[model samples]
Target: MCSGGFAKCLGVSLMPLAVVCVLCNILLFFPGGTTVDSEHITQQVWYFGGILGSGVLMIFPALVFLGLKNNDCCGCCGNESCGRRFAMLSSILFAGVGVMGAGYSVVVSAVAINHGPQCLTKNGTVMKWTYPFSEGDYLRDHSSWSVCLEPAGVVSWHLSLFSVLLVMGIIQMALCAVQVVNGLLGAICGDCCGCCGEVSM
Candidate 1:
């Protein structure tokens, strides 16, 4: 594929991940859609932003990485191909950070999207799963039990979008690790399919 075409293809793959991250962030506000009290605490919203927004931002590097990687590889400095080498190295770093950030973001997304719907108050004690409090304040203050109930009275569990993203992050991290190793150690795989195409993972 041509460099520009390959880049466009990568962009297409990255778009869905970005959308999912965004939707999850939006859901972070509601938890169960229309039930959360937005005025309750600033920290609650902040945490939500941290997780969901952070996750989506993780894909930002995909653009830089793909563009840089599309250039020719240079084993020697000043070979002009070195620019692609620099890009490859930059991608490994950027993708590495993205992987970690994604772990946190996915975990937040999973809970916000999948787990925040089933909440209920049992007797005087509100069900435990829903943690809309930002912090674990509910665990210590039984008096705040009312806050536990969604306006609709449902308790949700802790399921995070991280389950899937975490796995993807791990896989990418491993691949990048291989790239980094190859870069630093100058290991060759006795194979050819074009330079960067020799993906270790």
Candidate 2:
């Protein structure tokens, strides 16, 4: 397939993943699918890893890739070949942005997972919002989840959603990395395999 077409496919795939990441981040705000005080919510949810890093940043590159296939400059520059090559070359920058954004999400998600969720916990006579589990201590032992006294089932909710963000971020990074190479190939090879016929005319 042509580089532009491949990029278009990558763009299409990224759109839904970005949406999913945004939704996952939003859900993180309401742990256990119930409303809670904003102060009680996990700190990483405030970082906007899925919303800003993966969702908004990724959309720019996806839109750029989607438009690459139809890019034409015959009327503007009287040189469709040069215009197409320039567009492809520019796409590499957007892909780098995507890579960085996704990487940010991955780092935040990993840290959140390690820290566990913020919830009301009983410390002697007082109930306070705190991280009840040590780094990754609760993941292996379901019984340890009882330490979080309020925001019922928050431990499971936190682990599941953050895990999704981590996996999705990794996938987004890989896709953007692939686009960097695809953009380079399109720049060098003139965007499409059959463009030689049009150039000859």
Candidate 3:
């Protein structure tokens, strides 16, 4: 195993990471989780829960692979090809999400800087970031919630994770990338035997 190899990744890693993600989502709701809609059953069970869940599931295998390949546990399973590929691609996709999510936050922050956060009136309910409008009328109605979008001195947990995730995401991408290359190489190598369906047209 070379340095920084997938050998170090194990399914156990998934366990802890999943726990953290789920915990974060739980905290997010009480502490306030972003409310939106998305697709995928990702680890986080809100907004984009499905997508996040799928992403976590996909990445989980990489860790499992570590257990199988590196730790000599669960050797030579069935249908590894498709599962491995799915996991690889999904991991890359999920991890890459951090980049995109942070991009939105950055843009929101910039807009906030330009124009103060706007107050919004939905169902005649007032919602400001810091000061809760709970059941009150939105004093500052129908404008840019840009300030609310970005809290002052606010270090977003997502943003902070984004930084860390970028690195981990890169590693995940690289790992899956290599796995993809390996898969391709394996397929090509297998078919190159030149006996099954090679017809020179």
Candidate 4:
């Protein structure tokens, strides 16, 4: 395989890149695992979507590489027309999801910069104090009990991870754009070759 060849380079490069995507998602799972009500939902969704969408997008390269390796021309599986259609549909969906992920990453980064660190809310009123100091502490101090949101940790790392995911999302979107074009071409070819009925390319 010529290193200079576009197809060869893309196929070879994607396999390892896909692995990196998978690893990044796994790491993101920890911080993005839980969600709180209110504004936290949106924040969590963005982070989660950014991580998960990239994972879905990674599958496209593998499918493309397999088709290339087999000289299948269009379809992810083989030369079958139906397979190509499926690949096209999948590409469209993946691309849509990737776009969402990218948007999510951007929102996260922007919010982190403008709003600073995030936190979870706890209703202090709901909990019954076991000791007099706990229950009467507020009374003794003449302080009022209320719900409070406390910062879990700094979000610098979270922002950094989302930045990586954003890049992946953009790259995946471009790849899927190509897949959409390939799918259209295959569909046109299939229509023209209806009489021959030979899907192999």
Candidate achieving the largest TM-score: 2
Candidate 4 lDDT score at position 93? 53
As a whole number from 0 to 100, the lDDT of residue 27 in candidate 3 is 39
Ranking of models by lDDT:
2, 1, 4, 3
lDDT of 3: 0.35
- Candidate 4: where is the Cα deviation over 4 Å? 1-15, 29-47, 72-116, 119-153, 186-201
Per-residue lDDT value at 180 in model 4? 49
**How many steric clashes does model 2 contain?**
0
Residue 134 of model 3 has an lDDT of 26
Q: Which of 1 and 3 is ahead in TM-score?
A: 1
Compared with the true structure, model 1 gives a TM-score of 0.51
Instruction: Tell me each candidate's RMSD, in Å, in order.
Output: 8.0, 2.5, 11.7, 11.7
State TM-scores per candidate.
Answer: 0.51, 0.92, 0.35, 0.45
Model 1 / residue 201 / CA error / Å: 28
lDDT of 4 at 7: 32
lDDT of 1 at 180: 45
- Cα lDDT tens digits for candidate 2, 1-201: 778888999999999999999999999999999999899999999999999989999999999989887754232233554677788899999999999999999999999999999999998999899988777888889998999988998998999999999999999999999999999988877677465645557
Off by over 4 Å in 2: 72-81, 197-201
Q: What digit string (tens of lDDT, one per residue) describes model 1 on residues 1-201?
A: 333234335444555665665554455455444544655322234454343444455566556545643433423323433344444445456655655665565455444433233343454544543335434444355465455554432223222433334344444345334434433332232112244444433
lDDT of 4 by residue, 135-192 (tens): 2233334222221232232243344555565566556556545544544544444312
Q: What number of backbone clashes does candidate 1 have, counting pairs of residues 3 or more apart or in separate chains?
A: 12
In every candidate, how many clashes are there? Answer: 12, 0, 21, 0
lDDT of 4 at 97: 47
lDDT of 3 by residue, 137-160 (tens): 322443323234432212233333
